[model samples]
Target chain A: MDLEDLYRILRTGHVQAQGIVDTVPDPMLVLDSALTVQSANRAFFRTFAVDRYDTIGQHLYDLGNGQWDIPELRRLLGEVIPKSSAVIDYKVEHDFPHIGKKIMLLTARTVFNPDNVSHLMLLSIVDITDRSRKEAEFEAVFGELRHRLKNVLGLVRALANQTKAEGVSGEEYRTAFLGRLQAVADANDLALSDHGDDSLDALVARATKPFQTAPETIIVEPSPPLTLASKEIMSLSLLLHELATNAVKYGALSAPAGTVRIRWEVEQGDHPLLRLSWRESGGPPVRKPASTGYGTQLIQFAIAYNLGGNVEQNYRTEGFEAEIVVPLERAARPD
Target chain B: MQKTILIVEDEFIIAMDLKVILERLGWRVLGPVPKVANALRLLEDELPTLALLDVNLGDQLVTPVAEALRSRGVPFAVASAYDKPELIGGAVLAGVPNAGKPTSEWSLLEVLAKLSPP
Candidate 1:
């Protein structure tokens, strides 16, 4: 078709030339250099809940219930006027009775018609609230994974140092060393696992998995469930493992007739307290080890250094006694 | 008189190394011992010119030993890989020189110099 024929058909068959922009699905607005609302599409009118016909020839800031920032938009318009294209996340809300929320990502460009004169600034806004919300959620999840992975790595380092001096060159020593190493790994794995509800008993049960077998006597006193912090959980797990190993080797658990008693109780009035005790009796007479070993060091390190808790071990003539004292609410501030 | 020096070290190999080094330095190494109790018992008998102590004797923190050395007026030096200055007790940091574990002959002599009767 010829140019004249195409122009006549578009003008006569379609609605008026000025009314075509009003029917678009995407919310769009046209502005002039004076920051005036030259025209607005029907979608724009529906989005801001304003009459587009009445909004035309009004100031851009006057539309949208005067929520569109006048000075701030002047700055953005300056940029788009020079660059001919700019996009940004924009927030526009009405000052009069809060008409409607216009939180959108908008792109604007300066347009010049065949007249060769810059007459309009065309702006298209897109709702991207869902995308930004998802991005935030993903970031938080990623951060949590990184932190947990680092905690696991730190546990591995502690295990490596704990087992390094055992002199495990031969097969027998190698087997014992590997078993202890796996125990540490297992504790770390449990720490990473989820506890649907906060329960201290369940956590301690998982931590004592390695030493809960026969030939070894382990007892847990009945107590109400308590909440514990992740750091406290990890540190306490390794500390208990070290103690249980020592009990198996030198303390009461080492002997057939010997027994290990684990007891804990929480006290609350003003400041809460979590007190635990490990007593071993009916074993051979206990004597202080001439040399402290890794097991003992690990228990001390975890209690004193990592968890900031108190520990006292007495090698009595009858048996070994260990007590640990800590606050009940481990996740308090400034701790 | 062979002046004695108590070695408060946890690892047997490292204790033996200290004994060898102290003896080679011409000082009598008494009880390259691992525990604090043994060192305390021996301290009642003779006054050592000095002591080479490992800050961490496995589970036994050497704070008590540092205090004992201070009470006896015997000079001592601390040696540990993981010693933090902030966590160190007052006696541990007061006038006592610190040398890391697995020390060289030169640094051992440096520690010995602090024990000299000045």
Candidate 2:
């Protein structure tokens, strides 16, 4: 080949190689045997926020005011790589002065000449800061799910044992226990599902769906959209279940013309509050119970104890009414 | 002295069930409080003969309440579904008798037996 043709071919090949290196998504550096920066890719420059003027020919350890002078990096390049010739996925966790913190996986390989003389090391950095963070978040979510499952089973057991079986038939006891168990399971399903719908409306609809005999039997008034935390979902579901069960049996859903209205709104303030009202009408005339039952206590406990909220129940002669007030922040607490 | 027991469980039904069981066992139940703050306040007013702690209370851990019980020299056991003691965390709760939840009357009796030595 003519010298002019050879020069053009070599120039084209150099440009192609540079283009390939620049296209790499991960930060990369070509370091000499003495660990001086021989070259860097576009990603490297962009990642470290440095320019070729300050980076090229500079010692790797001295780059960016010695930010690259990590003890682990020094060990890998100075000692480990010489013996191994290449190190793959060596972890280096460091807090950079400019960039807060980074967890990096470095894959480095020695570039050998035709005579097998290794002069340059190709170091590629895969920033795992975001990936590792997501992994950790997954672990936390998994742990929380396991915890919730255990607690649910525990609560179920407690329900089975605590369901008042005294002076009641075996069949009656079974029905009562099963009803509470169903409430717990339904609540847990709503809490743990990844449907991206944790709205209070969703919880109410799910919890009260089984008790509805007809479309207009129970009316849910159009309420502002409000989301609830898993904990709040569990507590509110149980409360709603208890209230609906009572209504179905005697208060609102028993008679043909019976109806129940459910509505809620957020009260804006220094500490926001969620006020939900359940008013029952058009059923058998209501009378205050002579003694409070387990269901009554459970309804109270679900709000007052579980959510640190207050519940006001009025057994009006016409129908039953309940006002539930929960602190917005408390209701939205992360599980 | 009344055989009073403090119950530290967040779940309303579970706490109520524990109270019923403890009452039936002839132990006067103290506050079956759901929060750490409530339990601590109850402890300030009175120290029960024993305490039963649940590992997680909503968003808070029961470690502070467990520590409070320990420093008061009141013996306690964990009533939780978590089989692993390490996951429960806290030096005070480790190796402490655990009555695994879904706790039967027998399991509770076992924990209660260990909690108090007549």
Best by lDDT: 2
Task: Score every model by TM-score.
Answer: 0.55, 0.78
Q: What is the DockQ of candidate 2?
A: 0.74
List runs of model 1 lying over 4 Å from the truth: A1-26, A30-57, A64-72, A75-79, A82-104, A109-121, A127-152, A170-194, A251-259, A281-287, A316-319, A330-335, B1-118
Here the TM-score of candidate 2's chain B is 0.95
Candidate 2 residue spans exceeding 4 A from truth:
A1-13, A116-118, A164-174, A185-208, A214-236, A247-292, A306-335, B24-26, B80-91, B100-118
* Top-scoring candidate (DockQ): 2
User: Model 1 clash pairs?
Assistant: none
Query: i-RMS values of the candidates, in order?
Result: 10.9, 1.4
Residues A1-335 of candidate 1 have per-residue lDDT tens digits of: 99999999987754564577766676888888676887778788776677757788988777655666655565667654576455555543223345433346667777676676656678776655556678889977885565345434433433443364554576755655566566556555554567532345655676566676663477787765666765566556666777777877888877788878778777775667777888889778899999987667666656555344677888887989888876655352221
Instruction: Supply DockQ values for each candidate.
Output: 0.04, 0.74
> For model 2, what is the alpha-carbon lDDT of residue A217?
82
Please give fnat for model 2. 0.89
Worst 10 residues of 1 chain B by lDDT: B82-91
